[model samples]
Structures are given as structure tokens and as C-alpha cells.
Target: MWFKHLIFYRFTQPFTLTADELEEKLTAKCFKPCGSQDISTYGWVPPLGRHGDMLTHSAGDFIIITARKEEKILPASVIRDALDEKIETIEQEQNRKVASKEKKLLKDDILMTLLPRAFTRHQTISAYIDRQEGWLIVDASSHNKAEELTSCLRDSIGSLPVINPPVKNAPSHFMTQWLSPKAVLPVPFALGDECELREPGDEGGQIKASKQELTAEEITGHLDAGKQVSKLALSWDDALTFVLGDDLVIRKLKFTEVIQDQLDAINAETAAEQFDADFSVMTLTLRKLLTDLINALGGEIDEASRGEYIEKKILEVSKKQQTAEETAQETA
Candidate 1:
């Protein structure tokens, strides 16, 4: 299946687990339906859904996995109504007001009682570990969901050494620069018609524009006024289109006709065959896209470079603080 959103992490060290080893580890946390009283249950599932029995699907050097989470849906209004009735009944019987502490306990008890009857919903997060590339790209729009999958993997396999990919330059800075007048975008990257711009600083407001020329005078006017691009829509070599955020999250991904034509040529009939073909194509395309993107944004900061960068930043901050303290002393 195609991922709608991507939140990827870089492995600090090489991932060494073989496909069989990883599969065995994941089985210990195989997904199960939520119990009657359980509020939520999360575990690994077969990436091929009902088409295959293996929880981990190996495509060359990539190992694809899926995590399923089933959670009970207890409406807040219903819970509030139930809690109110219970509290009223208790108050009438005892002739005393309920304290905040007791109200919390009552809420917990209400949840426990409601969970069994509450409707349950299920969602799955699919991700792949590109052992060759040292990246774990999750099909989740939010960081929390990506973390959930990574946490489960850590719990299953004992250790997961990954971090958000560090960059040599801020993405916002480069993205804004890309839209400036006479600025040429990097190879394979062409601007689209959507972008989000925001003023600098914590209190700065933001503006979102769609179906408008990103490099037009009207948009450049805002950039001249000190706003920076926070989210930008762009296409990579006409293969994929996506919105790139300042945090490096990719959203609103769409595959172009070129990719669709490739899939069509596969002429796969079965569900499993189609899935395998899609996975292979998607992963290969993504590897190239990510490589070009990282290079365009001034490349990823490796561990050694990151350590030096952090140290330099710390010293700069210390120097500024010292200067401020000296100024304060002089003023006093």
C-alpha cells in the first residue's frame, strides 16, 4: 500500500538483524484484538494484511512491518453524562459534595465500566527499515504515531538507535531561499502551487496559500516582509509530489502518472503480487528522492559533524550569556 504521509528517522548505527531474526522478535508482540475491558491494544501485524502470513515482508534489503492499534471509543459526552448521574446518585444518598479527588476516581471507574461496551476502532501504521540506507520511514503524519511504532520495535528487539535526521542547514532557510527571485531550485525539484509562510520568532503569525504562484510578486512581497517558508509543495522528477515541512516531515504525497504507468505495466493480478510490485517501486523511488532532497538541503549531518555542531552552538550560547551578564554588571 502507498503511504500518504512520511516521518522518517535515521539509524545512528547499522541495523544488523536478519529478516528471520526480526520476524521472530516481532512475533512476540503480534497484534491481538482488544479484550472486553482493555482500553487499547497495540502490536505488530502482517504487512501484507490477509494476503500473507509473515509479519515482516522482505523486499531486497528492506524489511517492511506494520503496527496495528485497536482502541475503544468512549464518547466524552456519554462518559460525562454517566459520571454526572453516578455522582448525583452518590451525593443524594450520602448528602455530601464530591471532592475533586473522588471525582477523578469516579471518572476512572466510569471508563472501566464503559470500555467493555464502547465501540472499538482500528488503525495501522506501516513502516520499513532500509538497512542499506539506515532509515526508518513510517507511514504516519504525526510524530507521536511514528514514535509509537519505534517504541514498540525497541521494546521487542531491546535497542533502537535512531534519531531525527540532522541537517547542515535549517530546512526553512533553504526552502525560503528556493522561492526568492532569481533563485534556481535544485535538480529534480520543481515548485508547486502551495506554500505556508510565517514571520520569525515565537509570536509570529503564519499564512497558507494554495493555487497561487509561489514565486509571484504577491508571495515574494510577504517574503520581503520577513516571512519564511514553513511548508512547501514540490514535485521530485515528476515522479512524486509532496508537501515538505520545516521539520522535514513529508505530507500529502501523490504518485504521478509515470509511477502509475509503471505499476500498470507490472500486470500483477493477485493482491499479494500487486502489493509486492508496489512496494518495490515505491521503496526504490523513495530512496532516490530522499537522497536528492537531503543533498539539496545541504546534506545530513553525520554523527561526528553533529557533535561538533552541537559543541559550537553551546559555546556560542555561553558566550552570549557571558556578554549579557557583563553588560548587566556594568549597568548596575
Candidate 2:
């Protein structure tokens, strides 16, 4: 599993659950197929699939959890055709029009009947919790989808101490400055032709430009005339690119050949091995890029704090692994 997107959040308080403790709690919520009568199902699943028993995959200071959502896909056209046929039969037999409520009931019944035969769609959100960093990173592109994963995790563990981290300096303001006349980016970020500019206040003007230099006079005039950038498309060292939003949500990611080429060369014997290699390559590259982006966005963080956090978390993880091994031995 290569992580595609990120929705970053910070923990407001300590999340002290050990790997064994978290695994035990999540086992009850492990994912299962949607039942015949149910339209959907949601639960935790092992990141390594069936190869791993623990629902949470722990690596040093980081633990990853995958949340799967399954939903039945009942076509509207099918339901409408079925409803029309039934309505026609009823009208012919009763020689009368159906009431509104009766029609609604009929539609509901049709949906329930079709649900069992409907195709199923599955979506999984992989979330990584950095124990020492106190961050819960979700590979989710949308806010509602990420919240669904958070909500499910809360239901399982009975607690979640995380919330969206506050952004001090607005991203729009910074992005506009970068695209301004002869602007030099802080470090790695560079302006691309793609940008969504919106006029602030009641006037409500908006426009999007793509594949055109952001430094064009027309674009600068809009910015000079008070249009704020809500979405700034940016690239980094020609290796990675993403749309940076006003809310700091990164979307529409495209990694260059430099990053993808490494993973493409990997030839693993098992699904687990391939997944691990893919994940390691992606995570290592992304983690560094994200750290730089946070700094560029003025999300000030102490380096010493990070070092201390990682060290402490690694020790705790080691202890938990040893204890789990001991428990297995005693059981044997």
C-alpha cells in the first residue's frame, strides 16, 4: 500500500494504549462482509491483511490501522423501472392512484429487495499514528472520509484525543506572496500555472488558471486587486507535486518518475513483502516532504521535541513487543 493522500491532525492529549492493548480492543471491530439486509459495513482490518493477526501494524514509534467501508451499489434506474412496473400493476388492479406515502414505502421496499443483489463497493483508509509526534495521519483525500475513519476508531477504542491542528499563518496569504512579482519561495516550493483565486468579501469573484505562468500580469493584477488564492498548485524539486489548500489539505498528488521508479523496480514474492516495500519507499519520501511543507507553512515545531519523542516511543514499543512474546510463550 502506497499512501496517496494525507489529512494531518494533532493529538490534544496522550494516547497511551500499547500495541497489544490497541489490538485487543480492535479485534472486536475487525471488518466483516456486509450482511444481506444491511446496506453497508465498516470496521478495522489488519494493514498486512491476513498475513498479520494484529489489526494495528506497529513499527517502532508508528502504528498503522486500516479502516474498510463497504456499501451496496443499487442502481437508481433499476429501482425506478421496478417501481414503475409495480405501480402500473397496482393502478390496473385497484383502478386508482397510489398515495404519496404509499409510493415512498414501495420505493423503500424495492431498495431493500434490490440491496441483496446489488454490487458492493469497498474503500479503505489507512491511518498512521505517530506515537512520539502525537499525530494521526490519514491517507484520505476528503474530510468526511477521514472523519469516518476517526469516528470508527473512536467507537472501537472508546477514545480519540486528536483534533485538527491550528494553522497560524493562512496558506492563501503565503501562496499569493509566492506567486507575486519575482517572488522567491521559502525553500522547496515553486509556483505552478494552476491556481484558484477568489475575491474576498461580498463581491465573490473567482477564477482558475492552469498551465500558465502564475507571474503573468493578469494574475498579479487580480492578486494586487485583492483576490486571495484559495488553492495554489505547487511542485517540489520536480520530485513531488500537490495542490495546497487554504485549510492546509493537500490533494491531487502526483509523484515524479524519480520516486515511482524505485517502487516499480521492486519484485516481491508475497503481497506482504510488496506492500511493505511500497509503503517504506512512499512513507520515507512523504514524511520528509511533509516536514518541509509544515515548516514552510509556518507551523513551527521544535526539533529537540521530535528527537525526544521518537526515542521514548521506540523504547515503549520494544517493551510491548517483548511482553507480547512472553505472553505467547506462557500460553504455549
Candidate 3:
């Protein structure tokens, strides 16, 4: 509600006024603008006027005197004087309306409905029901008058009630948990060991072996045999550095190397199945490699020292890979 009423003004031409001159003008009664101070300080019905501008009041006060760059210069004082006179005329009309017997209430007019009542020569106060809060909102140009009126209204109502400031907006209640920032957990993916293999010869002669496990030496042999790498495994420390950083990293190591190495080993194995069996088996092996890698990287991360390390390492490796890829592409 406050944001809606917040006003900002940008002058077409910058104003030139000395600090002393500005202060002097602000102090003058004739230069004072309605609602120049706190708008809500008065009451629900704050005095209305332009938020910020060079203007005049009928008392002949120059509201704002600042330099203008225009060739045909307009004195702010002169414009203010004219506007002030016009405002006086308008005030007279408003007074007449207030006095008119035929005037209709601009707001709720139910008999005995709480409405502003003159508290003193300079002050008027009122109370309104705040249905949302089940309370009453008081308004008055003078805080003293508002307080007095609040007491009188309560007495008239014959019930003990909470007195509150004017309600410009609805009551708000926030759930504490809702206001808390959410922690986004990293997405989970199955590790190489978890990947299931199709039966041997499922893809004709494309694959041969369908085993789920492969030793480190066997993995290296596959790489030597020129098979495409699909998965790889690493020690816990290596996995931690790859996924969570040496300081903060969190991505699992690629299983491509492991798969490739395994393929080579399978080729070298004397028990290697038929060409079709070999291809089929390698495909399943690749899947297992990926599953294992994921599992290794997904281990619980040390939140303190290890957190920052992992983050830094992950970033470094990612940057290096990206750079290498770019270089290769450029060469091509």
C-alpha cells in the first residue's frame, strides 16, 4: 500500500538553489505544501497536493525558486502566486459545499455510523471498522484528538476494544517456514553399477558380453582394445574430488573411460563370446560402469572443509573441459 503511494519526480531542467535559500523557503509558512511531511501522520484523510513541484500559496510565499535553462525564463515565484490564488478560490467553494443543506455524504451515511467529528478548532477525528482484523482504525490530523475520539467511541460502543492506527491495507500473517529460503537438493542419477544389461545378442552382433562387474585391470584392457568408453570408476578420494570439490566439487566422474577400458579387456579375454555376444555384453557393461560412477560420487559430502574444496574443484575441472572442447572444435 505504501509502495503504491510512493512518488518520485524528475525535473525536466535541474533546479539551482543555494542550501540557505532552500532552507529559508521550507521554513516559510507561505511556501509550505500540504502533505509535505508524513502523509499518514495526519489521519486516514491526509491533506492532498502535488508531491514535489515548484508552486505558490495564497500567502505570497515562493514555494520553490530554482534556475531554469529555458531561453524564455519563467519565474517560479510568479507561477506559485497565481496557483495559490486559484487554490484559495477552490477552498471557498469547498466551504460553501460543506455548509449546503442539500449536500450528500460522500461516504457511508448510515445513521450513527462512525464518522469524523470536530474535536477542536483545528482538529477532527473518526473511527472505522477494520473487518479483516476485527478491530477499529482511528484517524485524526492530531494524535491527541485521535486518542480522545478513540476513548469516546469505545465508551459509546460499551465494549472493550483494541484501538489501532488507520488501516491502509489488509492484515498480513506469514508462515515462518514459507519465508525460509528452500535448499535445492542435487538431482539424483543411477550409478554405472545400477545400469541393467539386456540379454546377450539383443542387438545382433553389436554387443558380446553382458556382465555387470569389471575389475580395474579389465577396464584398462578394454581401453587398449579401442572400444568406445562409456563408463569409468575412481577411488573414493578421486570420486569426491570429481563430484564434490577437492575443496567443493559435486558432479560424478564420467564412466566413458571405464567402459572403453573394459571393452579392450573383454576383447583380450580368451573366453570372449561370439562377435554378437561381445558387442551385446559390452553395452550392458557400459551401463554398469555409469551406474557405479554415479554411486561413488553420490556419497555423503563433508559440509565444512570438504564443501568449499568440492565446489572449487568442480568449477576448475568444468572450465578445463570446456576450454579443451572449444580448442578441439576450433582446430577441426
Best lDDT goes to which candidate? 1
Indicate whether candidate 2 or candidate 3 has the larger TM-score: 2
C-alpha positional error of residue 117 in candidate 1 after TM-score superposition, expressed in Å: 0.6
Clashes of each: 0, 0, 56
Clashing pairs in 1: none
Q: Looking at candidate 1, what is the lDDT of residue 33?
A: 96
lDDT ranking from best candidate downward? 1, 2, 3
- Per-residue lDDT over 1-332 for candidate 1, one digit per residue giving the tens place of the 0 to 100 score: 79899998878679999889999999999999999889899999999988999989888988899999999999899999999999999999999999978998999999899898899999999999999999999999898798789889999999987777778899999999999989999998999999999999989999999999999999999999999999999999999999999989999999999999999899898999899999999999998999999999999887678777656655764696699789999754
Q: What is candidate 1's TM-score against the reference?
A: 0.91
- lDDT string, candidate 3, 1-332, tens digits: 00000011111122333334433443322222123121122212211123323221111111111111111222446445644554556569776323222222311131112212212122333233322223222323334444444434334334333422122221111111111134122233221321111222335222122233432334334433433222221233111212211111122433345444545665443332333233344334323433343333343333364445555655764696699789999754
Q: lDDT of candidate 2? A: 0.81
Candidate 2 per-residue lDDT over residues 171-268, each given as its tens digit: 88788788879888977777766999999875789989988888899999999888999998888867788888887788887788988788788888
Better of 1 and 2 by TM-score: 1
RMSD of 1: 7.7
Worst 10 residues of 1 by lDDT: 309-318
| Global lDDT of model 3 | 0.30
> What stretches of model 3 exceed 4 Å from their correct place?
1-122, 141-143, 163-332
